[model samples]
Target: MKARFEELDFQQTPMGELMLRRRTEVGTGTDIYEVKLGEEFLMSSLFTVAEEQMATLGLAAAAGDELDVLVGGLGLGYTAVTALGDPRVRSLEVIDALGVVIGWHQRKLLPVSPALVEDPRTRLRRDDFFAVVRQAPAADAPRYDVILLDVDHSPRHTLAPSHADLYTAPGLTALAEHLNDGGVFTLWSDDAPDEDFHATLASVFADTQAHVVDFDNHLTGGTSSNTVYVGIRQ
Candidate 1:
């Protein structure tokens, strides 16, 4: 039997102190991995239904096979790994601002980390995803069929002030340019769907929708909800 709880790794990032931890579930004996940034919990293995749904909802919006996908955040590899599960996804590029977090995956410290590192179609890039989307893609740059973003808390709540622009019309327009015609942009928001943000997405995409995803919150003993916003590029 392994230790019931363990601190896997710790790092000081520009964002704050980041820690990866594993705890054994008492009733089920399942090992749950968790990531914490500063005083806030970023992600947990036990509550990954919404993360997986982000990729599913995004890819479902994108039309056609041989899809090239880009994931704006790579927390614990849930979003990227879920996107890769689809046989239609030809390629996947995962961009994350935190290099230390990427290192954890490369080191196989996370459960799905090995899958991400070993996957031929997946490429993990350490960079600001918002910065990548805000600029026009070079003539030779690859356009994505789907872009799944799980970086911020929501359109109104971002980790940093700099990330606020991506939720605006002009910022979304710039992101649209990085997608192929009919490409999909999906966002994972911790809050309920915002009407103003929906209007912003509608202004940028040909079609848009917000899905309220409900999941079991073990800590709360009740259901918790998150939003997945999907938009199809014109």
Candidate 2:
């Protein structure tokens, strides 16, 4: 099974020990993939409906309030790039825990997305996502109007157990602290949400809703169901 480019096998990730590879076909570059635990499919560049929707919904919920945005994950840089496409966005802070992923985007992966990787309004931060949220200032002015998270497959089933904190009571409070008045938060999960995650959102925001979107993934030649949860800070 040969594609235009070869899979670049690398280190293990928190989700599982995995290899990174690029997919190309018909002399055109496709996207990248992370093969987890040698069998489970992780993320790929082929389908990005959920990633794009996360940003789109977040911005719409913000209702022109978000000048600066903080995206919790930098997967394929889709959400970050999509948010940056908006002229109203003054700044973007993209936080990812894995420095290697960032390195790949800066080096091996930039050719596929030159414009997004080199955007002037973007700031890439290498740190644990929750820590960044916790450190956010309590002051009103500097808060992020929108917070978009695409870091995990779902709240119930996470790649990292430590991430559960982000869906907990204290975590919800921390996230709320960083949100400006009437701001919005969007979370993307590969699958449906569990009851606890749903309740957690209800506990955190004034309004909450689950949105389902269809995805046509080009890499695997399959259709997948993706869901997003939206929370508005009252």
Candidate 3:
């Protein structure tokens, strides 16, 4: 049987309006992305291995004396909800540029089972991710033990082209500012980043490494693998 998709309902944002659709196979897709941001694709359900890796490995490495987390995009809220499951996590904040996507979670279109939204530990912010992260306090700054960023596609290609800047030296530097000592910054990518990009991260971070997770399930046409990069702030 062929896959099915419903027409996306749109909502406004600082960048522009974004359209999202419901897939019989997955949870939802942003029309502009043609990319599904839920499990099977983006991991809407906590059952997905990718989300599990994002939360478990990413958060575990970032954990410290006291835990706080900052997730770049809300998507299906799997990353946020999964972080909440950790007893060490004292606070969790998720920011997404598209208000409509966040609204869907509010309306329960996505099952955030751990209940991060209602949990006192979680704060959902609908704002420009760059602005939010940059302006976030440095002194009283929410020094996140973990910062899991899944904003764009990857360093090679991105869902939002403008976000290419976030992968740059300056962007990575700004991201570093939010981290407490020993904090880990992990980013999920559809493909491996160019060699120089990794070098850029190494300049700002004491330790950095890339991990690849294979997903034989073809979304568009051919087989594809995913990579996530972890950068530790010393």
Candidate 4:
């Protein structure tokens, strides 16, 4: 049997101290992969229902057979891999601010890294998602059919102060500008449904909704829920 706990990789990133670790549960004997940013827990392979759902729900609402998708975060490669699973997606670009995070995938350090790196439709770009959307797209830029954002914890709870603006009305409007007609915007939030954020999405998009996704929590012995907010541009 493998060791009880093993640190896979560690790096000092601009965002903070990034670390990946694998631990085998004593009872289940399942190896669980986890990511840590500084001292706070960021993501875990054990629970990624909402991250996968962000892509599934977004692409399901998209109105095209061939879709150009944009993913605003690439944590453990769950969201990006899920998006690529759909045959309707023609292209996918994932934007992440931390180069070290991207390096983990490029080096095939994570389980889903192989799928994300081998896919022809996927492009992992090292850049700030908020910064990219905050600026106007170039004249020749192709508008995205669906945009999946899984950066911050929620609209109000952000990893950094700079990310808070993207959850606002003006920031959402800028995000909408990058989408094609009938395009969809999906966001994964750790918080429960936020009425204020829903209202802000409604102000910027033609339609909006908050979907609560439930997943089994091994540690808690009960199911936990995450909110996925969808907005459609007309």
State the TM-score for model 1.
Answer: 0.97
Q: Candidate 1, overall lDDT?
A: 0.94
lDDT (Cα, tens digit) per residue for candidate 3, span 1-234 = 534765445655554545555456455432222224332244334134565577777876874656988898887677778778888888888888777777777766555624866799888788778776655465765577899987766786776666777788888888788888889999887766557878888888899987776654545565556677889999
Q: Write the per-residue lDDT of candidate 2 for residues 1-234, one digit (tens) a residue.
A: 566566665767665566677666564554445444468677776667788888988887886733889999886777888898788898898898877667777774544346666788788788998776766575554688899998878887776777888888678778888888888889999886566778888998999988888877655788777888999999
Cα RMSD (Å) per model?
A: 0.9, 3.2, 5.2, 0.9
Candidate 3, residue 106: lDDT: 75
Q: Choose the strongest candidate by lDDT.
A: 1
Go through the candidates in order and give each one's C-alpha lDDT: 0.94, 0.78, 0.71, 0.93
Candidate 4 achieves a global lDDT of 0.93
Candidate 4 wrong stretches, greater than 4 Å: none
Off by over 4 Å in 2: 1-5, 12-18, 25-39, 108-112, 135-141, 193-195, 217-222
Q: Which tens-of-lDDT digit does each residue in 1-234 have in candidate 4?
A: 579999989988877889999998888898889999999999999998999999999999998789999999898999999999999999999999988888889999888999999999989999989999998899998799999999999999999899888888999999899999899999999999999889999999998889999999978999999999999998
Q: Report how far residue 123 has shifted in candidate 2, in Å.
A: 0.5
Off by over 4 Å in 3: 1-8, 12-17, 25-48, 135-138, 218-223
Worst 10 residues of 3 by lDDT: 31-40
Q: What is candidate 1's lDDT per residue for 1-234, written digit by digit as tens?
A: 699999999989999999999999998999999999988998899999999999999998888979999999999899999999999999999999999888999999988988888999989999999999999999999999999999999999899999999999999999999999999999999999899999989999999999999998878999999999999988
* Decoy 2 TM-score against native: 0.85
- Please give the RMSD of candidate 2 to the true structure: 3.2
